[model samples]
Structure formats: C-alpha cells, structure tokens
Target: MVQHIRLVGIEASDKQALGYTELAHGIPHIEGEFGDVLRRSHAELIGLCAFIFRRQTPLTTEWLRQADNLLDRKLDELQRLPASHPLDQTGVILPGGNRSSYPLRWAELLGEILHPLLYRYRSELLQAPIEPYFGSYR
Candidate 1:
C-alpha cells in the first residue's frame, strides 16, 4: 500500500517560488503530481519536520509515531522487495536507510535547538511576509 504524507505549510507566492531555483534547479516545483524522486524528498522533509517539531509544546505525538512507523516499515519493505515498488518506480529515491542514520540524528538535534530559536527571534518583519521555512534539506 502506498501512503502519502502531507506537507504542512502555506503555499509560496509567485515571487517566492523564484528563489527556489537558485538552489533547486534539479528539483521540480513542489506542486502537481511528482515523480518518485521528488515525492521521496517531500516525504523525508515531512518526517524530519515532524520529528523536529514534536520535541516540545503542543507536540503532534501521533504524527510523529506514524512517521516513525513509516520509516521503519519502508526500510524493511525496500529491503525485502525490489526497488520497483510503485512508489520507488516513480522517481522517489529511497534514502539508503543505514548510510544516512547519523545525519538524521544531527538534524534532530539541530531542530531541537533551532526551531525554538527561530520562533523567539522572529520579528514582525521577519515573521510577516514569511515563507514556510523548509530548511535547506533538499
């Protein structure tokens, strides 16, 4: 079964979308139907966000749990099956699960520290006219 994860964020304005190109020339626009690679990146980003945000405050524990389960399940599924799973067939690259373990930990730690700081330091100018801060993890 294919499960889709929703990315929680406001849409970018036409102007806002332009900045994405400076870095993500290879990444297609984060809209419409995507191929496998883009979808996989989106899923990873969503999981990372859930892990980081659930650390404190009104934590979304259920979402985090589901993400964790999905991570584990996907890893196992990928190992037992071929890379030709429908999701995999589309362009979604499976993060080679083991090789990336440490980076994910580092991201969690950084998120724990930074997410709060971002909220604290945000100004009317900084906070207003703000785009959803998808950190540079493309």
Candidate 2:
C-alpha cells in the first residue's frame, strides 16, 4: 500500500512545504526523494516565520539556507549527467523499471550527496515537530 505523509495545522499553511513536496516528487529514487521534500519543507517554514512578524529568524533562515543549498546541489548533480548516458547504455540489459548503469550511477551520487543533508536537517528540526506549523508527517 502507498502511505501518505502529512503536515497540517499552522505549519501546513506554509508555502515552502508545498515547494518541498514538488521537488521531492521529482526525484528518481525511492529513498532520496524525501531529502528534496524536506528541504522544501524547511524553506516553507522559514517563509511562514518571516511572514508572521518574524522576518526570517536566524534559526529558520539558517534552515532555509541549508535546504536551498541541498536542493541546488541535487539539481546540479541531476544536470551534470548526460541525458543519453543514463537512458541509453551500450550492451546492457535490465528488467522492467531498472535503470541503465550510467543513470544508476548518477542516481547513487545523488543519494550520497543528499543523505547527509537530510540527516542534518532532520536532526535539527525533528524536535521542533512543526506538526502543522513547519514539520512533515511521514
């Protein structure tokens, strides 16, 4: 079954969370998807905080900055791979839904790049739990 994640309440009201969801849904990996999503989430939180008479608190701003950096890195990595390399490899065959070596490598690198950022982001915000105000529901 497909599980749905939710973050509602005051936090859910943030636009960054929506952005995070969009980025996450774009990832090619089953696991790494959340990193982009979380980054988007943190960004939304920061924006919401800024709007609520808080003009980017140092804490929220820092999180947003980190999230943006992570996203930029992911995008850069995705762009670095040649379109054909991953989609078309020489003398290789795979089962349905399996990617070619080049693309798989690109995907792995993306995982490597995203894992740490995700852990750090989670570590920092997990406690805050923005149930509806800033955190994601999984």
Candidate 3:
C-alpha cells in the first residue's frame, strides 16, 4: 500500500524547499522523487474517492466527476479477477472478530485524515473554479 503524505500550507512550502536543496545534504535528485511522491499521494486520495462513490450515479462536483472518470479508465486496463485478489483479502481484524478488506481499511484510514484535512483547508480546497485545480494535476 502506498503511504499518503499531506502537504498543507507550510508543510507544502517546506517540502518544496527540501525537494530543491543541494545534494551536499546527502539526498540525491529529491525534486523528481518528491514530485513522484506527491503524485502518488494524490492518486491515493483519488482512488479513495473512487472506491467510496463507485455506486453513486453522480458526484456533486465536476472535479470529483473527472477523478471518477480517470479512475474508471485506469481500472479498465486491469484484467478481471475470477476470485478476490490477494490485496482484497481481509487485512484488519477488529475486536469481536470483525474484519475489513484491505481496500476498505485503506479507505477508512484515508477518510479519517482526509475529512479533517478537507475541513481545515476548506477555503483553499473549496474555492470556485475547481476544474482548473484538477486540471493542474494532469
């Protein structure tokens, strides 16, 4: 599973600086690696969104619709599984024998952080003309 890192405000600034700092600090080619990490983090969020709303007929925002479309296209490339894939096996064994699948566990973990992150950064996240924000990712 990919670990998602949140880069809000000052943290984002710090990461940007760290990505560009010279190699004398012992880190090599950090900017490209940082960009890749950021992209994977964003993809995780997009996947969580896709998993949560896969059954919904329509999403409330255009950005969400676009994300869903992207996820759909990406998923289509994979071959169908006749049975549950190994990653789909139960991962979280809760108390009293309750269990959650790997994907569900991932979604739950992401939801815990993402909901609050979105709320805390609502002004920036919910600004008008959201399509451009999604487009920038492309």
Model 1 residue 137 CA deviation (Å) reads 11
Q: Candidate 1: lDDT over CA atoms?
A: 0.31
Backbone clash count for every predicted candidate, in the order shown: 5, 6, 0
Better of 2 and 3 by lDDT: 2
Which candidate model has the greater TM-score, 2 or 3?
Answer: 2
- Taking all chains together, the TM-score of candidate 3 against the true structure is 0.22
lDDT of 1 by residue, 37-137 (tens): 44443312222232223232322443355457655755654466544333443345456632222112222333333323322322200112222466775
Q: Which ten residues in a row have the lowest lDDT in candidate 2?
A: 14-23
Clashing pairs in 1: 36-90, 36-91, 36-92, 37-91, 37-92
Q: Pick the candidate with the highest lDDT.
A: 2
lDDT of candidate 2 over 16-72, digit per residue (tens) = 221121123333343566656555544322212221212364444655676577657
**What's the best-to-worst order under TM-score?**
2, 1, 3
Question: Would you list the C-alpha lDDT of every candidate in the order shown?
Answer: 0.31, 0.37, 0.31
Question: Please, what is the TM-score per model?
Answer: 0.24, 0.26, 0.22
